[model samples]
Target chain A: MEKPVVDQAEALRKRAASRRRRRILLYVAAVLAAFYSFWPVMVMGLEGYNIDLGVIIAGEAFKTTTLYIGGLPVNVKAIIPTAYYYLQDLGLEAYPRLVANTLIVAGLSIGLSLAVGIPVAYVLARIEVRGRSLISYLLLALRTMSQFVVIVPLYIAYSRLGLYDTFTGIALAEQLIILAVVVWMLRGFFSDIPRDIYEAATVFGKNEWQVFRRVVFPMVIPGVVVTTMFALVLLWNEFLIADTLTGVATRTAMVGVWEGMSINQLSFNALAWDSLNAAGFLAYIPAIVVVLLIRRYLARGFSLGAAR
Target chain B: MGAETRQGRRARESRRWYLLFIPLFVVVGFVEIYPLIESLYISLTNLNGGASLSNYVTMVTTPTFWNALNISLLYSLSSTILAVLIGIGLTFILTQELKGKGIFEAIYILPLAAAPIVVGVLYSPSSVWDDIQQFFHFILHQPYFNELTPSFYFPVMFFSDAWEWSPLIMLVALSIVNSASKEVYEAAELHGASALQKFRMVTLPAVFRSPVMQFVVVLRFIDAMRAFEVPLAWTNWLGYTNTLGSPVDTISLYLYKLLYSSSLGFPLGVVSAVAVSLFVVTLVGALVLLRLMKAVGG
Candidate 1:
């Protein structure tokens, strides 16, 4: 008995030591991976700040001094108002409109996706229809089709249909990508709802539509919200379709940034750098805000889709 | 008579449910399918709008198409492989017992939320490229490491894509790992399985068994095959050396150049042919991926 007890204690201690070592190893690996992944963003953020403040920390021009604020030594530096310079280069009047246009395009695209996607997802989830798998495959194909491939014909079609450069046209073009994702994600959510709830509602003399409206729809509100958020993020970050389809009237902030870079390249204009970085910063802000706000939902949404 | 009527009503109701699909089908058909058909038709015709096999013949014969195709394959294969490895590794590490795992996981996935364009700009010659060059030069202490070359572009593009997409794979892996039955793991442990054995037997198989994992793998493959924004932005910054046989011009970028470049001025027929070819390639690639996954019991 004594020998068995001693052996058990020894095994327990060994297990505890191994577990501790594994935990330490995991933490170290996670931190390193996180750093590798986020280093680029950090570099970009720092670059943006340096440009916006007209301070080159890497250069000898950067100066630091200790300031006595609230009886504490605080690091302070001379900073130029590069924001004003950026604004001047960007043409203060054009900047707000550019931001507004990006917002409008993102908003309209999300709206269009939701309006068309929910009903279709409902059918895909609830109704046992013939050729459901075929529809799913079609949606997947649409999702996989390179925007470049579709944009070619769509460009010609848009120009012919008088839809080019219009908000509605751009929004519709954005829908090509957003719709597939919305439908697929929403379908996942809708299917996750317990079938017994829908059956119970139907047995109470509710029509299929009524059951959808009263029982299924409410249950998937969280899903809709998350899906919409995901779609919004995708649209807001969208550059390809918006770049190809939109003209002067409907150019988004992303396009503005791209054009700024192009102008700098083509003309070797120095001021364009300031404007480009500023525009890049502006374009990134909403996505950052959205990610921060909906981080949990975004994680849940991605995992949920994968779970299906 | 009553039973027949009930069956008929049930049939009618199910049929009406399909009516819900009509609006979606119309929009997709009008926006997606119709254009695709029109494009395919254009691909099969000559400049004079007459039916011709010239475009297809040219696409097959042209070295430029093959070069672009090769570049695209390289980009997609390298990026997808690296991303999946990193993603799976991160998933395994993250699932281990660690403090502040949530924070680490959140930060790891931040790139997913970022726009590809933004990621492109961030990694382009303007921002992190300089830092990367400097870091590399310092490590190697070689003059050759200082300049960004065609070889450098591959890794840059690969890292940018992997950064943005690895999180997606991680998400899928995590969900699969988390949802795995604890009993199964315990059973493996009870069998006196080593850590490596447990992982190989229980964890890896379980994760791969999920259909969602298979879907993600296939989707990532397809997406990588069509990589556009990052490479485009990178090349744009690097000054558009997207000539017919250029090293870094991906298939989509090549197609974009064909359509947009004033000097090239490719005819619509040829452009459409290339587009159709790209679509077919994606489809075939997807099918192959699915088959591979199935073969692996994933």
Candidate 2:
């Protein structure tokens, strides 16, 4: 056999060139990703600074730094904090009530869904029932149904049944979203426990309930916590149902923000960008904190707990 | 006799487990099924206060209804596809060996915390669009693009949705990509596979063929179809729109108008018919997708 000659320097040069290209690509991608992810948030926060291009264009006075690039003026305002004033304009009482309503509704939703969902999820996971896939598909179908489809009828039903405009009503209506998630996630988590452990525990003369309590429940406590947090996010941010169902007393933070937008629109003849941005940023605080807290479990949660 | 009794006892024990599903069914039945049945009944009722298919006739005959249907499909399809594409890109970048990966990942996930209303408010014409308009005006000497046009409205909606949701897809895909063995890629390289060949044979299959990614994709698609918040926030829940089925109106928005803001009255029957139709459409879409997922996954 003829021996082939190797061009070592050329190979090294080619590899280095490829690595350089990759490195450049990585840098570009990272920057784009950063800009794409955070631009909206940055815009929201920066709008709060009350940056006025007109002021810079006019070359006005009072705590303004103007930068000229390509003969275009960029005015960087001195942290005017207009958002705070707008929040103040939103009034103090409404904000607190909105927060309380959101919290109460969220609390009730989480408690109810978990109480009802855990048992269903556990049974579906461990038992091979004939109606298993049917139940699952039903849940998935409900999840996919448009909020308007269900909420319209629920609106009429709640109005007639005296459930309208109550905290309990809002909480109950939220179950349409929360229960599906709770069951789907908990089922995924419950199934994660190997069947061998379950079988071994059963072989030790433990009943199905005992096996669940001692073994399965203990194993998926982390999952339960994550599910609770996820449900809380869903409830806190829920708009359409809460917006329609809630009256003045039960107005959630999200509804409050919408009301703020309408108020600004009607009065000011302009969208209250600064105040609305401020309100939105304020409203998202709890969700952000909770999401960060459960960041590690997010891969599973985002997949509806289908992925591990 | 002992063996028969023992078998009967085991069957009884297993049957007891079905009782656990009672609470779930009760809540779902009262909350969901009752309303669904009521909607069906209402949809069958006519405008003249009698039982007929008049609402279904209206739904099928209205041109604006068809337009709303088209807009809904376009919005949902574009947003879902964009979300997956961007998510795949983010996943690729994120999985590479890079500095500050953790921080980048955290930044990416920040959008998920944003409420839909907030996303809508953030992307409204007077805010981000104005900024973008100024940018185009300054940089390219382009005139301010009218927001009412479909060209502008659709892209803004798509981008806003993709921004808010792609992180979720990214996270799921990242997990899948991370869980895959590195040796597979190395083996492909050893086999003298080109970079494109290696990616096609290795990375694409590892991520797309997984059931989890498929689930996430379908989930996004289905969720996107329910596009409500952005359209509502942009228009102030039709506070600004003069007519039903405006340019920005998705099917959900159109349905809301039919139910709440009709010129004649609450067209309850027609709205209910639309809701029932939507229910059927979403269910069928979901079933078809799940079937497709299984086929592809296998």
Candidate 3:
């Protein structure tokens, strides 16, 4: 008996060492690969910082043949040189409006999503619903369908309903992709909490709404923020829907980049390259800000398949 | 405490909880199921390109669907394996007591956050990656990089995407790896066990079945394969933009054009069918891969 126990201990000990070494190696590999992936944007960012930003913006303006940013040539060209162009650029209809447009869409999408997600999540977390497994997995299945696959039908459907080219259209479309995911992630987090917490709420005379607002909401706040970040980035960066559902009037940053590239009329100078990079670099800011703000949410589970 | 009152109270509780599902049911029914059903109706009908799915059926039955589907499968499998292998590698690296670990993690996760289309635009196959492509071209003595031909294009794309998403896989794996017990390692060392043997016997058995952890890693690259934006955009960035806007295009891109077309040539019926098929595959792939990864370790 002692020999068998000793042998088991020895075998377990050996395995632990190998696992630690392997884990160490894995982290090193991740760090290096991460540096490699980020190198391009770093280069783009540095290029914009060292050179004339206005010229860069100007270069993109005239450079891409397909970029139909403005009907007026002067309007496109003159806006690049202002001293406060980055923030001021937003107001020019071409830049700031698009930024604001993206924000508005992101805000509305997050709002609409939470309105539905919280209740669904609350039930999944707290209630003993029938068909729970079926419901949970079905939502996952619906969400697993890539956004591109469904964009066309939704676009055509929305267009038919005259909701095409609108924020509501895209927000509704996004629900198809991320809403279920948010619920799934939050449900996992919510489920882990002891039911006795809710029982205690009941003993304290808290109604469902009061319990949710006071007890559940604060505990899940981190998850919600992270979920919102995921939702924001998903809607902000989604391409198929943007390309099909909305036109230039409501072009998101991605559309701006796509429309620019498709037009491709660069003047072969550093300025054009810089502006192109600037726009591309600026395009990443919303994603960066959202993730950084809710870095905790991004740090864990909601992103396993998509958020990562 | 009577049976009748108890049953009635249980019924009342359920009704309240069930009401919460109203929003879920409505959203799922409209946004997800409706379009899916509508797409099924389109796939079977004959309403595209001056003909019905006769035109559509011919196209669906053509060698193209099989070919693209094969490419998608290849892309997904290849990327998934790459992400997993690379993810595990990075997890090993992350376990080291290295400086700047936080920065490294941030760098690794950036791609997961950025939209694929934007990646496509940045890495645009049309004219994107020319700088890096030119380097590889010089090394291999291939002239294809200069003109950005199809033969030279796909390799560059594969390199760019793998580079983009592989870090994410590692982050997922590392999260699991990080949570592992340290005392287990000290015990193994005290017994004088070897490093490779320790991992083989202990670490693999423990974390391998972690579904939330593994799914988070593998699910990403599988999703990457269905991607229309990133590969197409990067190829175009190299200057042959709009090359993929074709009937024989990616299933998603194909559906995209059909929906947005000015000519109304699309079979809405066929598009819906494709969407349904898309939903099924996404679900199945996630399930299958989840099972496969566990089997690989278990």
Candidate 4:
């Protein structure tokens, strides 16, 4: 009780040091996080190097998913459950068609995203007409909802329209999901076109359509490239819709991973962990490299669009 | 040619060009608008194949629904806070004018191209990260995770989810901070402001909304709530991961069940009610968030 020293400065230093450590942890976490998230690309490498990896992976998938009843483990013979699979018996094993079909769906989504996205963006951004705010908000809200909301209604609607399990239906669904993003991003470009240039073009006796082709269209080329690349990267990673919408021969890359997971039981060892990990990596490699190539938009500062 | 007639001819041509937008609207309306409205209608009526108010009533009182709501809330809140902290922290460091900022940025967006399902698997502690954790198993045995036994695996998943999105948050925060006027910072420095003082008064007050910027990072979390692929694939819709909203059971998942099982007498009325509730909750959240963005932006 005799001494009363208020060493406030010392306390401040400790707080500062601790705060610095916390920040360092986040930085370290970001770096390690990058590594951890991308670890699946390693699996894609494994597939490229060896054809036998499929059996090894399939064999491993079987071990993880096999269950026991009343403490007796299920036999491996029944674990694979389908011996009639000519690959499992006669043994050419890996299905190339599975990979190709998924690529078809992904390709269609990219095409439609750009094809439709380019024009809607031009109109929304340049026209500046009625209901623009509402349109922008609609775009924002649509992107936020998961595809789960639309699955049943769309399934019913598609069945009515004869779209179930067809490539056209899946591509249409993919474009629907990504349309809002494309429009939102593209509108910014459209609005950024200087009005005076359009006015100058119109003064030359060029009509509105001529002005669009001559002035505004040429100005937003960079925006088109950025949006197209970004759209491709996003559409490629889409999984939930692809999982529910496609069927046997039409299944996409992500659905292949999902189907593989459905077959795997989580409780086991070297096999379950490695093979699924491998398949997931295979699905992610192309997507990762493409995005990294055009990362500027990914890093660009928050741009106020007067829209979002 | 008469001038008025020429203008009229041009106007007709312009209108035709606008008609090109019709196909775009068709795709948008067919895929986006109609299905959205159909879902809204489905959410209103009890959807158990035969039709009745009973499924909606049961859903309103269901404990599982409450758990999903709570899990979503926890995920949104904690994940939002962690994202903001990670974002603001790294962005603060980036503000130091470091040389490798461009490379640092590339590293951050790499995960955007990654599939959520793949992220889910990499985060699957048993398979992808166990090798890393085997190293940690020696130093600190995580007993706090023992309460759920199976959740012992959750730490890795949590880290993975946080890792995947932290860069996104960082990128957003960096944008706002970088846009701040340098004059204000110079004035603070001349006044002998400590680094912390510069951060508090000069930084936070000037760019008061960086935290909200970081929160937009959770748009993915909201999206994740209904995404069944990863949670279903990893947890197999188990009691712990989606106990509140099991795979095929969350309002979103329930919609899928109702759609596919409509043949099996799935309730359309219940599906519709839950879907409507999800739409309303999301609409309200979006409105609140927008309002907040405007306020803080000012």
Q: TM-score of A-chain in each prediction?
A: 0.78, 0.83, 0.71, 0.66
Cα-lDDT of candidate 2:
0.78
Model 3, B1-298: lDDT tens per residue?
A: 6999999988998888888888888888878777666665556666443434453565567564555566566556665666566666666555555678777766666766666665654554222354455545555555544434555546545555666666665655555556677888789878987655566566656556666455565566557656766445533334433333332245554445445553644445554555556666777866655464334331
Per-residue lDDT of A84-147 in model 2, one digit per residue for the tens?
A: 5345534777787889889999998899999999998888777777776678777877677777
Better of 1 and 3 by lDDT: 1
Per-prediction interface RMSD in Å: 3.8, 3.0, 5.9, 5.8
**Residue B242, candidate 4: how far off, in angstroms?**
10
DockQ of 3: 0.36
Error of 4 at A103 (Å): 3.9
lDDT of 4 by residue, B82-150 (tens): 655655565565565345667766765666677766666554544434433443443355422231233
What are the per-residue Cα lDDT tens digits for candidate 1 across B74-153? 88888888888888888877766667888888788778877777777677776666655554455556453533487777
DockQ for each candidate?
A: 0.48, 0.54, 0.36, 0.30
Question: Best TM-score goes to which candidate?
Answer: 2
Expressed as tens digits, the lDDT of each residue in A130-159 for candidate 4 is 554565556556666556557668888877
Distance from true position, residue B80, model 2, in Å? Answer: 0.9
Instruction: Identify the superior model by TM-score, candidate 3 or candidate 4.
Output: 3
Better of 3 and 4 by DockQ: 3
What class would a CAPRI assessor give candidate 4's docking? acceptable
Tell me the chain A TM-score of model 1.
0.78
The window of 10 residues in a row where model 3 chain A has the poorest summed lDDT is A76-85
Candidate 1 lDDT over residue span A113-161, tens digit each? 7888898888877766788757766766777787766787888899999
